[model samples]
Target: MRREAMRHRLTEEFFARHSTVVAPDLIGKLLVVGECSGRITEVEAYSGADDAASHAYRGRSSRNDVMFGPAGHIYVYFTYGMHFCANVVTDTVGVANAVLLRAIEPIDGIEQMVNRRGRSDNLTNGPGKLCQALGLDRSDNGASLLSGEIGIYDDSWPDRSAGRAIVVSPRIGITRAVDFPWRWQLAAERNERNERRRPGGSRTP
Candidate 1:
């Protein structure tokens, strides 16, 4: 990808919808953070109030305050008294919705990721792992994605994922709201089912 051609980033409007919609559209998109970047492959959506699994389900707090602020912002949090997880804040201001970035196929800065994660294989196969590999933590919680080290990008205008099939499944790792079926991913590259979801709205070369 050309440096000038990749200048366009996913704007606030791209993430202004419910996380469920944004989640699937994110597949095949590039997630860039400073020198590290990757192609987003999997994500899961969570919303406020109705979603029992969401941190904002019990209303806002210091930890989840960013989720209700705006669109296209990072909503990072620590978990399991150990690893951190990164989420993309979605929907409009005052609406608590986010998409958990579950997995990515490394596209840039692999050596840095390997060093951070202590291994190359499966470096970003899970949410916690992805965050660790990307060096994201609670400190990045409220940063805007528009013009910073963190941004979701894509190829030239109108061009998209070649209509790759998006696999829909129930979200994992949470006991509550486990059957919402909001998890979305590209159908494993080589899978040959006709099922497809076309993504619209992206940066231009």
Candidate 2:
């Protein structure tokens, strides 16, 4: 099948809603950072002020002020004192909600991503991993997704298997709010297909 060459960027209006509403919906979307692009495969939602796991739960600080900004902006931050993670701010200003990008299915600039991460099997299967692979860090914080170095695009291709592809689980790597099923990811079969579609696989270019 021939693929179409087009990118429909998601509008800010799409993100001016609850983080939970946007988290699972981001699956299958395309995330672009400079020359690299990938299909979003996993994400976690964090609602500020109430969600104990959220950074904004205790109110705004210099480090988390971006989370309370307008929607459709990147909110990059450092964690574990050594790793970086990226999130997409959601909801209207002052809401302080965001969607953490956990994993992505590399679709463009695969060689670059592999070089950055030194591995392909789990290049972007985790938040910190994906951030490193995409060269995102504190410098990318508060960047507008509508017209910035980091952006999410609509794949345009019809995904008839989306319902079967998505699965939910409690957010990982977090000790608080463990009961909320706020994490979403592509199913194992979908991940296998993604791997098979890579450069040296049967679906090679």
Counting clashing residue pairs in each candidate, in order, gives 0, 0
Candidate 1: segments with Cα more than 4 A from true spot = 1-3, 156-163, 191-205
Q: Against the true structure, what is each candidate's TM-score? A: 0.87, 0.88
What does candidate 1's lDDT look like per residue over 48-114, in tens digits?
9699999999999989999999999999999899999999999999999999999887878999999
Q: Give residue 10's lDDT in candidate 1 (0 to 100).
A: 90
Superposed by TM-score, candidate 1 places the C-alpha of residue 199 at a distance from the truth, in angstroms, of 27
Off by over 4 Å in 2: 1-5, 158-163, 190-205
User: What's the CA RMSD of model 1 in angstroms?
Assistant: 7.2
After best superposition, candidate 1 residue 114: deviation in angstroms? 0.6
Query: lDDT of each structure?
Result: 0.86, 0.86
